[model samples]
Target: MSQPPPAAHHAGHVAVIGRPNVGKSTLVNALVGANVSIVSNRPQTTRHRLLGIASVPGGQLVLVDTPGLHREGGRLASSALNRVLNRAARGALEGVDAAALVVEAGRWDEEDALAYDTLRASGLPVVLVVNQVDRVADKASLLPYLQRINEGREFAALHPVSALKRTGLDALVASLLAQLPEQPPLYGEDEITDRSQRFLAGELVREQLMRQLGAELPYATTVEIESFTEEPSPKAGVMYRIGAVIWVEREGQKAIVIGKGGTRLRDIGKRARERMEQLFDAKVFLQTWVRVREGWSDDESALRSLGYGDS
Candidate 1:
């Protein structure tokens, strides 16, 4: 098939959607060439839609990392937070130039089917990205897997990738870029993401908390940046002083985040500060406070106060 006419320039949004643990967040970071979203093996790690802008030769690819689509049940999944997240994920598809539905290379499940159906119904240009191929033992297995995926919908293209390994990413980006029309860049070429430094700072701390606490990380726990101040340094660099609070629904959850002698909280702060420093290209002084905001996840107004992507 002949390629579409080349545009002098291009800029468009591409929404990446998948079920939890399918490596959608990892792919966003890889495509952006920077860490714009938090990633973990845990389900629901990405709780909202995030934008990671990648500058290509011809255009900027605004990649939207949508939250994982899961079966909702009980009070937790039905809570105000969950509803907002799910809506935000689906809402991201609106007005996007194209969409990428990521699935594990050798695995298919009910959630994947639901996500596929949702994307098809949206009537957008869809690309099937079979991610995590590095974990697939048999390379030949992808042929049949790709066939099965194609049977469900008419995709623009199919690409198998290992988002964690940065394999086959160039082709995937090329495929999506082909579908976008020419336009001016939406953001500066040097900008990796549209999110604020404060928002990413809070996410880094939450990532550390999730990694450190593991199973003990409360579903209702959230991190908020109260004050983010920057000042000139002697070395002709800006230094950031940030104050943040970790809000938990209960006192016990607060104890888990703070830990004994505040060791865990300190660790979380340290790691988050290091990441912030690298991202901002400056030194960081981060102060984290653990506070009990009882039932914030369940409380509509409280979730609003916590603030997250598009919510």
Candidate 2:
């Protein structure tokens, strides 16, 4: 006799919450099999909740990548960063089937404890993901620390994985799948992320800037996709006209972004154009301009206009 059919399954959302730079973005990229969230060596790189959807055999898992949480309020940028964290904490995890609290292994400290406290208050089923195992000198040494951290919390499971090396991700994916609720897929199976090409193009430029200029430039910079137009190319056969505004805090910063003889800005534009071509699979006509937006991070109205708030 033929066996009964397997039960149909549904997709669910899973928020990857943790302090900044713990490889949360990398994990999301790995899970979704694409570069959905921008990754950089710098901290606080992700300022928004990037949603990446992964399709499993039977269900889909939506991962929400949030900015790293930290103490704030002294400076304008810090205050904005704090607001980002609060928004994620208050609503990002709600209605999700489960959450993966990512922590860097061998670097656990008081900050980790505070993150745990916040997660505990969320009242969501949590899974502890000890990321960056590759960085630890003695992997065995982490077990004792893990035990202590998990002492009081009621976590569904603990997973030690390295997002950079792509180690133990299968197990992490399996654990998340088991905890997901029964529901239909929220997005199409081919869809990987919710961000638009223009938004992603701006992010790509910002990522390159972060790598080249480091913290000195990232916090002071914002990329806005002013216009995105596609038409038949006069020379390249097909052309994507992408316009972006690079905002800086001071005239000096603007000059620096433009660089001597405009070389620096040219480099940034070239790199951004290349990445956009790859992402969109077409030729791109990229135009970038640097403008001074004094204290934009501090101005509530500016922040809201930039989609950093509920404006």
Candidate 3:
């Protein structure tokens, strides 16, 4: 008997949407099997629309990881920055075949509803992803929560998963792939993301900023890669020399990021360099400087200059 022919391949774009801090980036990173998107405990960690390609035996998923959908009226809100982030998230819905509406397991709120509404309005297949299931102490309680949220709502599929631990992802991936059109792969199997290495490098540095600075750091702070260059290395094969500027809205914020005697900045650079080296598979020499930008986050021109307006 002849062996059965290989399964037909499916490929298309799927937007990952959720409120801030709901593990959307983590889910994207897990699905892509790489750190294509940065993750932090802070809300709005992702400020851009990034494509993470996940290739499997029968299908390939082009995952559009987007900024968290959030309200912009809070005291901590940076109006321009928040608008940019929200726009990036909503804009990602355009030209997508499906959407993954991610929310923390056992909880759903107005922002979550907002994300679902946005996806529904696009007329795309919305797959409800209840992420972070590992944190749910009582697995039994999850059924009730899932049922409660599913009431009077429509979803192509629903999955309870833990993006951090990589559990329940196979089913989720299958559900998403099922919704995609049957076609050839959109990208090479080796390709993981559409973003360039330079952009990833800058994001890695910003990840350190959010992780290290926490609440003390201003919400308006952003990272700009002033310079990124590669050189041949005798032992490491390649080396990267990256200069990053940490843009802050106030001179006092600069002092805070710099810390006493520049130690804080040094630690941030050290950690960022380590991450870049790991991600790029090369040696990294990273230099970081904190500078005052005087409300750059709220300034459209400045935001555009700092690479904030892209979708």
Candidate 4:
């Protein structure tokens, strides 16, 4: 196939919007060919807006991955944190060329509708991304589900894909590129994300916390990088020395993260370091500690200080 001329290429920002835990970050990571955004099974695992840049054959996609949109009134929702997350997600929509409304292959709910409505109000071209089709035992049922979601809704394109498996992405990319305006690449092809390595380091530790602790983990718990230093290494090209502090609401939660005899914390640090080595492609020395923050998640000032502000 003949390559499109440089003047014919399309490049623009696209907001990835969805309800909590619908694999928005996973899709972005798959498209970017890197783990620029953190992923976990927990709802609202993504707390900030980050951009993943994917330079494909026909064009470049600057994907804005945002926190899942959820109602703030639930008992499980921290009013302040929920407000911050919702604001961050909504704020990410500004100046984007298009939006991708992600949803699980077989599921749709009020929150899904809310996300779609929010994007519709923005007046951007939306592409329905039916993600996680690999999880569906009955593939035939997906057609009806897709039709149901499409009812009374207008979308620039729709695709069923498995972000984890990286299937059905070529078509998705082509569809999204058709919606974008023809232009040059907005970023260097080598650039994968807008977030710095320091931010990603903290998120890697938090990903461990969410994956390991599961239901035992408190919503108030967050990872903060106290120190991030890079130094020369004899064997490796670069070495990163990182210090992470896990903040919890109370002493009990701190104990849960630290675990008995500090085994849990060690595992978290070890896994996080391995991931960092992979993502940064450099040796990493990571140290972690758990501390009680009383009520940081609820305090708007503290949340901003911890890097949870609207982005």
TM-score of 1: 0.94
The sequence of per-residue lDDT tens digits that candidate 2 reaches over residues 39-154 is 88988778777789999887789998887766555664366645755676446776777889899886777666767777778777888999998889887898897897788778
Model 1 spans with C-alpha error above 4 angstroms: 1-7, 309-311
The 10-residue segment of model 2 with minimum total lDDT is 76-85
Question: What digit string (tens of lDDT, one per residue) describes model 1 on residues 219-295?
Answer: 88888899999898888388889999889888888888899999988998898888888877898889999988777
C-alpha-based local distance difference test score of model 4? 0.93
Q: All candidates' TM-scores?
A: 0.94, 0.93, 0.97, 0.96
Ranking by lDDT: 4, 3, 1, 2
Q: Between the candidate structures 1 and 4, which one is better when assessed by TM-score?
A: 4
TM-score of 3: 0.97
State which candidate, 3 or 4, has the greater lDDT. Answer: 4
lDDT, residue 309, candidate 2: 44
Top of the candidates by TM-score = 3
CA RMSD, predictions in order: 3.1, 2.1, 1.2, 2.0
Q: Candidate 3 regions off by >4 Å? A: 1-3, 75-78
Pairwise lDDT winner, candidates 2 and 4: 4
Error of 4 at 30 (Å): 0.6
User: Candidate 4 lDDT, tens digit per residue, 1-311?
Assistant: 99876557999999999999999999999999998998998998999899999999979999999999987687556578888899999998999999999999999999999999999999999999999999999989999999998999999999999999999999999999998999989999999998889999999999999999999988889999999999998999899999999999999999999999999999999999999999999999999999998878878999999999746
